[model samples]
Target: MGTKFRSSCPISSALDILGDKWTLLIIRDIMFGKKSTFKDFSSSGEKIASGILANRLAKLETLGILHKGKLPDNRKTVIYSLTQKGIELLPIIVDMILWSDNNLGDHVDEKMRELAKKIRLDKEAFVNNYTGHLKSLMAAL
Candidate 1:
């Protein structure tokens, strides 16, 4: 969640909904690979606190960015998957990755460099194809 705001410029409004550092990183992790449980997300390098992670997940779910479901075999564990609205943000993430790669290449892996190059070449196609793959996986679940 975020601090309350007084009025709404649409851009400001949207940012307010997603302005927190932890929130964006959480979305990034989900977009990249972490999407099954609190454990998966907590282990991501940003080192989000457990209580904060739970709150942010709840917030994203409320904002329609994520949907929660139970595993078929184990009702105690929950799976978090991106909604179409959430998947729609992939191009934005891709662009951020490209920008980071340009500015911070030395620390990033060769595989990531290659993947970022591919993502930069055709961001829309990459996102569209990835979105389709996620949807297919969701259907299979």
Candidate 2:
């Protein structure tokens, strides 16, 4: 949504929005971790640059993948939460975990491997639980 599509191909368009490493990392944080603010993202272990984080957050919002707004209790504090479309990417993340553990086993940690196993054990249940968590968090917003 932030830029013109390079081609009419669906893959290209998706890449336009999510091809970069940082975007999905940002999504990973929001979807799986407690990354809800600019500070949280900037301070993550990935150490995403401040400018890059801001731009990615805005781009995700423009693409309707996230909702950025002020916290209800504190007008000045901000929050970034996933949209319905964003939460739909859970399976993709889970799949990537499986793939990473399979092909890049050395790089994946035991925790991630365990998660991938859990996902493999029951993909539907994992997806349901993750999506339910997202919905409940969004409801609180």
What clash pairs does model 2 have? none
Error of 2 at 2 (Å): 5.1
TM-score of each: 0.85, 0.93
- Tell me the lDDT of candidate 2: 0.89
lDDT of each: 0.80, 0.89
Worst 10 residues of 2 by lDDT: 105-114
Clashing pairs in 1: none
How much is 29 displaced in model 1, in angstroms? Answer: 2.0
Residue 126 C-alpha lDDT in model 1: 89
Writing each residue's lDDT as its tens digit, candidate 2 over 1-141 gives 448999989999889888998999999989877789998888888899898899999989998999999988898988999999999988888888889989997788787888888898998899999899999998888
lDDT computed for candidate 1: 0.80
